[model samples]
Target: MVRDLTALTTDMSLQEAVRIFSMTRVTGLPVVNDKQQVIGFLSEADVIGAIMPRSRDMSGIFLSDFGEIARKMGQARELSVGDYMTERPVTVTEDINLSTVSETMLMERLKTLPVVRDEKLVGVINRTDVCSKLMEDREAI
Candidate 1:
């Protein structure tokens, strides 16, 4: 698990979140409250989904032009992380076994998961971490 994990607050602007995502090179982040309790999860897909026009709402007009995409992004800048974050995101306990963590992530289709201890954020685990650990164990055998 990555102990030096970055987290997002619900009140943070989507633009700020995007900046953090770019700087940290992370595709997703756990959203926490003042108490550091994980409340939601945000991903690049979520951010893009928020800015893109839904098919039903598009009414046949394609947003293919760069100007149209830029306009949507500008509007998204006004939104907060809470507006698009996935509430009550699936999380794993700190003591969970690696196999269980892998299974959960696979079933949920998540690339990363927040690790909690007593319901408070502790760290994060991703698929890479799992693979690395497995490879290390194999080497040790």
Candidate 2:
């Protein structure tokens, strides 16, 4: 139900993905193969995970480790998007209903879902794009 999905390859550097995200004004993109099949998803969170440092989640120390954890987060960035992205990601078909797509994304905690046809990546649908459409459904916010 969604189209015009931006995609990337897992072999690409994380920096490249971040550059794409910044340049495209999209928070995330789908990771596909040479055949253009959905392989994984590269998201802002994944990018953050790649750049963010790996540290002990001391979220319970000093009466809640939020500060300590944040301190560690400041020094992270030792991985790549290929290292962070889930190897096996969820996929969808172009004929899938809009409600189904939306539900799957929300329920699966997905940032983007590639639209495939006969196992070929055709386009992408993302929560941000979907939400943007739904926002117009509202009379007022």
Candidate 3:
């Protein structure tokens, strides 16, 4: 079972979440509640969308179009995770088989799924993790 994981709480701001994602270079995280119970999830894509630069209606081609996008990005505020996190994300137990994981991911197109035991968060399983496992298995062939 995979063990290395980066966890954060729901109360954490999107700004902080983005900071952690940048610092760790990860794409997703488990959102835990006040009791340290896993409650939701946050993705880098969502965070980026939250701070996405607005498109300007510069019908006439102007050299300053790029400048406007930059200005909009700069003016964007430090958003909050609670405003964007996906609540009650799909999860699985550690004892589940790889086939089940593959089925859920394929059906849901999920990037990652938290591993929970006894209603508590423990680790995570993601596409990257499965890819790593597949590579390792092939190497053993």
Query: Which candidate wins on TM-score?
Result: 1
Candidate 3, 15-37: lDDT as tens digits: 67877888977788988876657
Give the better candidate number (1 or 2) by lDDT.
1
Off by over 4 Å in 2: 58-80, 132-141
lDDT of 1 by residue, 38-141 (tens): 99999999998877665534455465754666787887768899989999999988888989988988899999999998778999999999999989989999
Looking at model 1, the pairs that clash are none
All candidates' lDDT scores?
Answer: 0.89, 0.72, 0.76
Off by over 4 Å in 3: 53-77, 135-141
Error of 2 at 59 (Å): 4.3
C-alpha RMSD of candidate 1 = 2.7
Q: Model 1, residue 48: displacement in angstroms?
A: 1.1
Candidate 1 wrongly placed segments (more than 4 Å): 56-68
Shift in Å, residue 120, candidate 2: 1.5
